[model samples]
Target: MQPEGQAKRLVIVSDAWHPQVNGVVRTLTKLREQMEARGFEVTIISPADYRSAPCPTYPEIRLALTHPLAIRARIEALQPAYVHIATEGPLGIMARRACLKNNWRFTTSFHTRFPEYLRERLPVPLSWSYSFLRRFHNAAEHCLVPTQSIHDELAERGFATLKVWTRGVDRELFRPQPDVDLKLPRPVFLCVGRVAPEKNLESFLSLDLPGTKLIVGDGPDLHELRRKYPNTVFAGKKEGETLARYYAGSDVFVFPSRTDTFGLVLLEAIACGLPVAGYPVPGPKDVVGASGAGVLSDNLQKAALGALEMGRVDPDVRLKGFSWEACADIFESVLTTIGSAKVLKSRKVKSDRVIPAP
Candidate 1:
């Protein structure tokens, strides 16, 4: 239960949630858990609560079919002390409109690089997508980014009030298991994430590496990739202890995406004492650059082979500043600052009111 005097109610609106596993879902889940444990009443508004239709191209993600008025009514009924919009999908757009119409302050987060992702699949130009995104996020009091590199990139693109919000790994769940073994060929190179074009999975699969090349998780390109690469092993979607075991058993974790805002899997793999190899991109550069826990190079094949030489990593030292508790602390601090500013503005308006006519 919340303490007697504090206003701790929080409402989070997001298009990303359960039933579709990804970094955004995982981050929000952990954030909510951490907030609730600290006596905050957290309510998440998602597609699961309303009538929805499958997103075009990506059938796994559902889009809400309701109108903005419906979202406004829900937010009004909740009477939350703080509001956070987590994505820029249909639901997030409606929630943003609701907050604007009601003169309520809300914060947003930049999770995916939609501009680059769209360019990969469609003919949409990067400037057009980035403009829409900039406007969507600039409306919020603050826009939370996953890393400093991402923050800088968005700032250059004209996004305002950008703040860095790092991700964390569950140390207890994802740790080195000495006896666990996948029984695959030695020096197994693994990549765990959605099997989509934006993931750049083909880059890793095409590499002339030794031993096994295993993939975990599923997406639109799973069947086709499985058919094309018969020599590689695809373990499909995994969770909990099973997923942790896969990380611990792997010889090296290979990440190929060049557009990820921040790769949470990097932290997960490192927590399991597994070395990583990826391109010298934003996500990899921020997560593993000069860390000695992973290898980053323009030549991904060379990086993969180099990572094989990294013996064991101490998760305690590598993940010292990453934890759900720290993540929640940053989130709460941002909300508190916004709320405080709102109160001060109201007080100033009251003080400036004319009283001579009365």
Candidate 2:
């Protein structure tokens, strides 16, 4: 056990982590940084710490082949005050089992829409996958969702103790550069995220619109999509200011993924003063919702064209309630409440908004 006066220890067990570049990895990375700054000793247990094999189809993501006993032993050695399982992959499953076997309470977050994603790739029924997911998350003390739409959907599916833990953006990195130019066509329609089937990249690439369609990330389908859509520009995977400039330079940000729980790219795009165009789906619905920061429609072409007309606006007005500080506060509150109710009540109140189950 950790001696008194040591920072409150937090063990975050996730299947998603570097060097994979996706929202889950980004969110968890930021969470650790923010939590540590707030005086928590954050320990991340990922595939890098154990023997792993690449996930089938998605080679970039490695699946841990760790035994439950090994996971339990590691957790015991760490002596964490709280454990948060961030995914439902092999590592997350083993960690969940370890916590349960020891009668330890742990919290979880719903990051990916695996049920919809699996159905897009395989012949798996949504019901079968959701049943498995529902069971996986419901085992926890609370399941944190990114948006109210997702929370409602999961609640309808019978998930209990649900809470809303929204995401944040790095405004300093993704701000607008008025003079920056991609040197592409007049209205460059940009889409930044994994180029996977679940992302529905084809929906945007296949659109009949003006200007260039640019993809700014890499995934399993990068090669195939490149071969199929020769005209579209694939910028591969970009990071830091390079990634932000892609958003800043673009005229309209097009998000075609209907499966994403929350599109971090949407926040990134808006932060860069770029208007968004997307299917009136959960992600866009939640982020763009009456903000006038973007346009959403079933007609992808129409949405893109409409967003292009809106031009650039001050992002500060649209991104009022989003920040890494607030995100960490909500996360810490949940963990503290689950780990020790007294600590949660004693901490400075950054946010009092916790979504309870309907």
Candidate 3:
């Protein structure tokens, strides 16, 4: 009754989804939109509630639905050929088990360097926990990472099936118009993300920098942060065009996560023609190198001064070759190959079995 050939069904599994504001949600959202446009049906399995644009309770963390195993059963009934585990949590663990049970080849993504993020909360050494995380990811046919630098580092650490999957800036939405303005009291310096402990928002506020320091997202630490810096502006959660407008109107973007695998916001800021100033972490280091659109420093004094030099940035350079379509195309090709038997056999360690992951 239908066409001779049709798109394959794909399911993306993650613990952090619609309700959570994060890179995993952002990247998967883009990929889903693109794939659906070309006739593929995409479904997401996540703990986050989808009753609204975002979960209720300002910066709320909705605990996962009771008995995720039941939801996983439903997903299994759907029988998707291509599965992507976007996050490692109960939901993804179940999804991975589903794939393994069915011998269904699935792909995993390197959205967050969880080992590094874990070290921020717990007093654990990341180096020790790195291998376990690698093994968790290497269970999949392929692991998509944002940068070649990370790909190499992961490969060295025994994540054999790593692939580069870069983030793309929404140029049309983020491009500088030079007309719109938010008209803050003085100048508004923004650091947008979950106001959690690991992101290191305190470093920016502690800078003793001039102008109003604005936080544009809500998280667990909101109350504590507001209490510490009463003068700082908290803009709550914004979405779609409003989020872009916030990025465009801001004076500078201050990113402070040394463990961020990729700071997608850095690209958004450059697309909005706003320069950035942040830690010399992987995300900022790689993005700034590509765009020459910002400066990086570990020292608060140096980063603050770099924020001032934000005007000297070249935004166009960063916007140059980044495209979500291109990223999706690359993803599609890899998915095709990952579906093949020859590719899987080639990736085998030649011990006549699957290689032992890190």
Candidate 4:
């Protein structure tokens, strides 16, 4: 590790970048800020820097069409102290290859459940997808996950070298804005995130709960969901102060997703003094964690109603353990470990090779 004041370069390769406002993007953006604050120079290799094609069914997420040689050249030019692949997309694959061809050790992060996502849209077997992802991640020195539940789930599915890399909420930006006028009815049960099948929005929308059901954010399922649930208000995509206002304006933040590795929106809700209601699943299970911040139940209706009666918990205290600073600290430690592994491997190669006597 470098001295306290020393700055080291970190090159991050991710297929998911700007114009895509998801958890992975949010997490990476915050992570880069925190890392830079801690004396690290960060370089991002994203689709923005190369020619790209739109991902089918998800045109918002552009796929990099850059050549392998170009990727290697760019990475080599940066001469980063460490390389971290932030997604399992095209750019990540190229970066992995570059590192492997140069015999350089790199770290990777599993931000989404690709196997589950794929199975949702295709007739592909979960085992085949998991097997494919397993090979991609297994090549890395370490694979960072968001929660223990995810770490455990991935481990069960044959993922190795896993580490728990938790996420943090931007409390300053997501704090309670009780003064904002949502003009919705009392006990407004709001769900924020992409309105897609994987998010289980129908489970919440279909709930026969009293009060206005508000949906914040947009997705492919927006039009269909809007048509199906005419009573529920679809506010489309919201960000910055507007998003926080939506969070604070609501009584309960209903998270119906069963697939998210970590539902970052839950943290944002808490940060905005909104309680959560969701299934007792991985993402919500870890975040709520016995803190009276939210209610998790098998019955979505029961959970949503239960959350309305609960008072908002102090996010500052409830989420005292989570912060970008700490997240960055752990990330830095991981980079340091990878650097050490590189040094050890270099030594091993020298020690093992038979040199001719001169």
Off by over 4 Å in 1: 1-6, 336-358
Output the worst ten-in-a-row residue range by lDDT, candidate 3: 49-58
- In model 4, residue pairs whose N, Cα or C atoms come closer than 3 Å (at least 3 residues apart or on different chains), thus clashing, are none
Residue 109 local lDDT, model 2: 97
For residues 1-358, could you state the per-residue lDDT of candidate 1 as single tens digits? 2223236788899999999899999999999999999988899999999999999879999999998999989987876768999999999999999888777788999999999999998999999999999999999988999888999999999999999887898999999998988999988998999999999999999999999999999999999999999999999999999999999999899999999988899999999998899999888888887356788998999999999988668787877777888888889878821233333443333353412211
All predictions: root-mean-square deviation over Cα? Answer: 4.1, 6.1, 6.6, 4.1
Reference-based TM-score, model 1: 0.93
Q: lDDT tens string, model 3, 1-358?
A: 1111223677888777765677777888899999899777788877753232322333354445445466557666664556888877667777777666656688888777877767766788877788767777888888888887788888888887888987787777777766667877545677888787778888788777777788888787888998998889888878779988888777777787677888888888788777788777677877776667877777855775676665734566666667789779878766621233432443435444433223
- Candidate whose TM-score is highest: 1
* Candidate 1 residue pairs that clash: none
**Candidate 4: stretches off by over 4 Å:** 1-7, 336-358
Measured by C-alpha RMSD in angstroms, how accurate is candidate 1? Answer: 4.1
Candidate with top lDDT is 1
Clashes of 1: 0
For model 2, residues 1-358, the per-residue Cα lDDT tens digits are 2224423788999999999988999999999999888888889999999888989889889998878899989987886678999999998999999887767788999999998988888999999999999999998988899989999999999999899888899999999998888999878899999888889989999999888999999888999999999999999999999999998889999999998998899999999999999999887999887467888999988999899899986799998877778888888777732333433343444355322212
Candidate 3 or 2, higher lDDT: 2
| Backbone clashes in model 2, listed as residue pairs | none
Model 2 alpha-carbon drift over 4 Å, by segment: 1-7, 336-358
TM-score of each: 0.93, 0.92, 0.84, 0.92
